[model samples]
Target chain A: MWFKYIMVKLVLQNVSTLRGIVGVLNDILKEAKFKMTNDGVHMSATDPAKIIMIVLDIPRTGFDEYICEKEVELGVSIEEFYNVLKRANKGETVQIENIDNKLKIITTGKVTREFVLPLIESIEDAPKITTGEFSAKIVAETDIIVTAIDDASIISDELVFKATQGNFEVAAKSEFHSTNLNLIKDKLIDLNVKESAQSTFSIDYLRRIFATSKLAPVAELNISTNHIGKFSFSATDMFRMYFLLAPRTTD
Target chain B: MWFKYIMVKLVLQNVSTLRGIVGVLNDILKEAKFKMTNDGVHMSATDPAKIIMIVLDIPRTGFDEYICEKEVELGVSIEEFYNVLKRANKGETVQIENIDNKLKIITTGKVTREFVLPLIESIEDAPKITTGEFSAKIVAETDIIVTAIDDASIISDELVFKATQGNFEVAAKSEFHSTNLNLIKDKLIDLNVKESAQSTFSIDYLRRIFATSKLAPVAELNISTNHIGKFSFSATDMFRMYFLLAPRTTD
Candidate 1:
């Protein structure tokens, strides 16, 4: 593979939320860790419930010319960098350099305004989310399964992904609302599951996938009963993200 | 052209403010009137002192497919029609039409929400702006001039556009601020001096141009002693924008 970007960056919850306009980027990237040594930026930011790591590595090289090594405590100005790169498109040429404590990003097309991301202490104090035993991996069997389930969850605030003896179903119900989205894996991918486990999570968090639709080629989700779960996708590039949500009390 | 549209709306202001978003639109497309016909709607919102205009136009072809004819009103929600065509981009395919009391708008892309503008009756009354003595025509050559001034009237809340012989200059001065932005032109387009007048107006009203950088491709402006001016920009489309202001007592 041709080396493009040499550095990496980790995106956090609060910094991204505070800066994410139109709310598109927040949903797609979510909780992830990005490591950058000489390519892009190696930094992290978060709030109470999410942890995100962002890596700013280009598909090409020349980043080492400007990369600077600093302790993790020297938080990267995610907002400024994002705004600078925000003017750029996917394949456009962008050169990022650390000049005099300021990150300078230059895009190829119409010269966009210089963005300045202020360096501040990383707000890394989020709620500790830890889950115990979780076992269930059902490769997306068909397109219909993901679509139906995703749609059904739209109206309800929570969703239940259950893996039983031979059937795997994602469902939701309410007085005036009810949705049953199912998937039969015998005809599709490899399915491995023993005991039945049904857990509910906020659809608000689950909606993150739709935001990254352009880049999400594959999705691997890990779930449980009490703590947060993980949802990851690999599109043109590899992306790993997680969401830790506390389950609601049963009635 | 192929016809289509969901709804067409018109909003007018009777209460004139010192600074409003729509004022900028008048500066761009000088004498252009917002046309709300069967196909779609087109109007520019500007600030009162004439800086920019937020010009929004949704064509009928951008919608799916629908058509009908009826009297258009304001504020009422044509939800179904609005929802369908809300995602229409600047140059998207639209098909909007009226059927009975319902409006049908078919949009090419997915829509999250719709926008509706209020009508003339519902909006607060604005100043009654009328045609002035120099409201005639100007010779193309000598009529257009704009200059970005430096620290002259830095503290003064007003600027003066004085016409002498055949030249015009914008000047401002005060203890805290003294600056002038002047533009000179004299080859052609002639100005009819309404008794050779000068007026002082607030710069705050001119800041709204940030929203509208498009509509005012070519425009004509008017100035008087009382700080009341009329700005017009037109070709095939016609519009007359009025700006009312009290002259600053900068003695």
Candidate 2:
């Protein structure tokens, strides 16, 4: 009932993608689709396994607003709330409301603590942005490039993706054994080649990029020389993901 | 090389906290740490704003003994290695080794996953055979009892608690505006009320009985009530914990 902060209506997009993926949603929410709206942030996802559509809503403010009217209680906070919701059951009760100027949130089956945050300008410019021209496209001479890298990536700490005029490959080295796979076929996704360009990316973000296989799909490209590369994603939030490495000098 | 199903060893005692805290570790390890060990598990923890710990390790079987005379490269199963370590760090290099029969786990970063677990067999069947009739002690009973019933607890779905006249009072409630300060009072250690009479406990174990406090720290109690209570824990994998409620028809 006590009012703390007020704000004018402002709407913005929210998107996020998981840096690493156990599933598709993790990839979409944490990496590519970062969004934030006036009402709050929402994640509209479909479980690849069950193939069930999920619509999740998180209010903008972190407070509990109750209607002495209908008997319902909900709570949420900005800092840790998202982390909690990320793990909550899709169908669990999630509550949010605007009382006077304060917003309240609540989640079922968990204790609640009211956190009143100062509502700031819900402007679009405040979010971190990535400003760099990215290459429009590249031809993967070999189709096995990404698959090989991702496959070998399953064993090594980092994926050494190499692409060039004639060959493309992904490889990982360990004290016990080194894994290297070649991509000599397929031009749609992987270009048949020995090597053209090179870049080292976090398997985490790569996992996310792969998540978009169903949407905003990215075509394959072979990295010829090992060079650090960058990628950006915008939705509710903006991200600048970086991958670094010297070209695969040996292989 | 030969391949076999991948198996990693992880030993964590105390499953009670896993319901709430392990998720946090899941996030940090995704990029912060990776690896497994033959000896057990090891990692590094830190106070960096969002990051809590960095875990790293290798499986005991990962160590290649065939190249004993020379510095040999380590060979790890693709999916097996990825599946095991993916649960830890998302982007970091992870190494694991097995010497002899035991696995030795090591990682790069602050080691934080550490705790002592109480086994039910060791804690249950005895005070050399636990006796009945007693008094339970507490540091500040008013704080726990009063704060428990406040409006903050209105959203607390379950208020499961058990207490004896003199021994101890433990409560866990999953509701909004909840009063959990006492249930997880990380401050106090042993409350001297040891007049063991009767006690009531909560069913949900996610609610911490005492925050980072001692587990099974014996307290005296004056059990005069007609209710049965239980505190069950495993010695080997303190991970699985349970508290049963005994309806107190008579006080």
Candidate 3:
């Protein structure tokens, strides 16, 4: 009974859901601490520079099986975890458990494969953000934003997001070249504007966050002038992830 | 009229076919000379180490449009050409031409994009391979071979191929681990062995050569003991390419 209380097991019917989540977190954090509770799994971490913070919550209903007698913290290298998940083929179920301070990942498909990675003690403190009241919010197709990011990336490394009552625009510029993607209200899934807002962010961070677009079809964006911007992806109620990025002050 | 005679233009309906071809060539040669005639395009080059040679031929009938007044050689960096081809989206039409000693690539789909690469002088002589008489030939599903290579790569850096009168086998071994993929006569599309043979080759080379599995469904392998092994991939008579690798003697 004591050993059972200390152990936790999670089974995911489709590995890609977890794979996509870790892929996004790996971009900003080299290591992450996952808090497993009866409710679900949650992780919060920021980049070394504190320019980006990611918060993830996957409810217990999302997993095929979630067993936890007591809350536990599992800290592991994001890189190693990602590498292990890469070995899981499509339609494979992934089983994760901890034994003797080592995390074991077993994928069951046509054949079963197991990978073991050691857990580490995470001491880094999570950054606290006092978010400002957002003035504008826009929901757009994930693929469209990914395309816009790629198009602007060819011109500059920084991207500017402008939201007006009529439209939302993503623009980038260099010395001689500039590209802009304009999406009108008719093109978006939803649009809300209390006041017009504009902000600039690093394309590098934006690209990595959006790389998980395949996991979600739509993205919800919240912005306030000269403040942190929040971009979130979610399914109906299974999982939700939001990334907050600080804007460039000079822009 | 003279400019027309000196210039040649080629158009491919699907960009991925050429993309896949150049992707394989870029693995071995930095620069290569393309001989363009009314009949087709041919390229022959060997790695700098002279341990592997690749010969490629894409017939004129493979293209949607092919124009050549006279046979000419277009020499360019294979690396750069491969990079440019990567930009072409799926289902896009790729058009290539030579203008003022510069090679021009244009892809037409949602938008027309053009890229220019400088032609270089290719002075390296192609390696002549008097292929040894092959005693064993095996044709298997490209995907199966790819999986076998990936499995063996996990245990060792080199792979061994064994053929007998009844079956063909791919095997690899390390100090503590070993993997083997055995295909009997019924398992393979075709297997013929005049005499039993065993050979070893660098897994690094085999991996790259097999990366083009997406371009073809079946792969034909020809091998002889202690000699060069030839692996070829093609789609009927439209195009054919083969890789010849010298086997390790000490094995």
Candidate 4:
């Protein structure tokens, strides 16, 4: 039998943050693997198409009450979890429990609702990613990137990120239309570049990464010319999420 | 030549009202026929499936500036019109002009956007609807009906509306679940029933009609047992919309 005792119980005062996190994760991957430890909860997954990888960490302090008896990993359907969270009001308190290989979620609002989702076996382990020497790094408002991506998406499928000593620009162009957005040093929280670097990435993946904009106010971007890029979005002290994407060559 | 000069030019201080009107119409019909006159703009259509008919009247006072040189009827793709409106900020002014068999929409906000959509010939004339004497009438908050319809939709494809001397109730039941909502006389603006009346209607049509809830505060419901029903939603003096639906007989 796969039945087991209750291993993890978490209570959240507000479900908005969790909703935001799950919403972004669902956009990147259909299923997610959640690791619960004494320290906090962690989840990471790569898109099935192998274009983007996302890592998420939520500290114990982020939850009102988090209890984990032992280190355990559970597999959850990101889409189903997100749909259940949609039922919760922003101010509602959410309670989650793991029992007998099933995950139970309870939300307290004008009316209390409960949902039980069966747990599946975890997928293959996440790949170990190594960092590459980046030539440019910039920290800017999340809205700046999100809005630019949205605007560019209207015209083209690919967007270019150009970084220099003084400015970071996102531009996209098609045969008939083009959009260019510039973020100067004055608008960035931090900017560092040894030399100018430009790279293009798929706008589809960028949009999924930017879905976290509602949860965080700022995002740190690290890019190398014609290589992979990383985006780290931080939401105050609540949580931190990282996204890594491969760049498309100019061939 | 049909092309002579601009026939209608309208500037709206806010595009939200127009968005609301189009959103609901799009759900009912794909193409919409709009009739422009000196008094205001009018649109009426019956669903392609012939299940429901809707009529919209927006007065001249609703617009910041309204001009009409001659009466003209234009056919527009509701889905395309909605996509253009989506670009306008809720608080932004939208200027619309009909010129050379095309509708030009300009929205001014933090940025200005212009979209030109070609107008097709009117599809067909709106049928004249003669409503029978209704035995039950109730005026209630739009949100109440919208919420009840949404809740009932979760369990059944049809919902029954029952009106007694002092209470208006919306109820739906399936094999496994049921929902009942009651709006008493005290909670309604007005309620009048010569005798008890009950009728069932398709939730699909109800949802499309209630999509205009955000545009109006109150809806006047008129119905007779197992007959046709009319829902009249009015937003202050800006616009008035009427939805007529044929009830589904239980037999």
Count of steric clashes across candidates, in order: 85, 146, 0, 0
| Residue A121 of model 2, lDDT score | 28
Evaluated on chain B only, candidate 2 has a TM-score of: 0.23
Model 3 over residues B1-251: C-alpha lDDT tens digits? Answer: 55663377889888787888898889888889999888899998888888889899999988989987778888999999999999988889999988768899999999999999998875476967788679899998898788777766765788888999988888776543455667778878899999988889889999888977888999999999877899999987568999998887772
Question: Which candidate, 3 or 4, would have the higher TM-score against the true structure?
Answer: 4
Can you write out model 4's per-residue Cα lDDT over B1-251, one digit (the tens) per residue? 43358789999888888888888898998898899999998998899988899999999988999988899998888887886676676777889889877787777654444566778785898799888799899999989998899999889999999999999999998887999999889989999999889999999899988888888888999989998899999876699999999999877
Q: Per-prediction fnat values?
A: 0.00, 0.00, 0.00, 0.00
Instruction: List the candidates ranked by TM-score, beginning with the highest.
Output: 4, 3, 1, 2
Q: Candidate 3's residue-wise lDDT over A1-251, tens digit each?
A: 55753477889888887888888888888998899899998988888888888998999888999987678888888987886777677887988887667776777765455566777876475877878789999999999999999999888888889999989999998779999999999999999999999999899999988987989999999998877999999986578999999998772
Off by over 4 Å in 4: A1-251, B1-4, B173-178, B182-184
TM-score for each of the candidates: 0.46, 0.32, 0.55, 0.56
Candidate 3 residue runs with Cα over 4 Å from true position: A1-6, A174-176, B1-251
**Better candidate by DockQ, 1 or 2:** 1
Q: What lDDT would each prediction earn against the true structure?
A: 0.42, 0.34, 0.85, 0.86
Tens digits of per-residue lDDT for model 2 on B85-168? 434432322334333322333333344221221111111110122325334434433323333433223434344343433334
TM-score (chain B only), all candidates: 0.53, 0.23, 0.95, 0.94
Candidate 1 accuracy as TM-score: 0.46
In terms of TM-score, the best-performing candidate is 4
lDDT of 3 at A97: 82
Candidate 1 residue-wise lDDT, B89-130, digit = tens: 544444333433433433333552233332232432223444
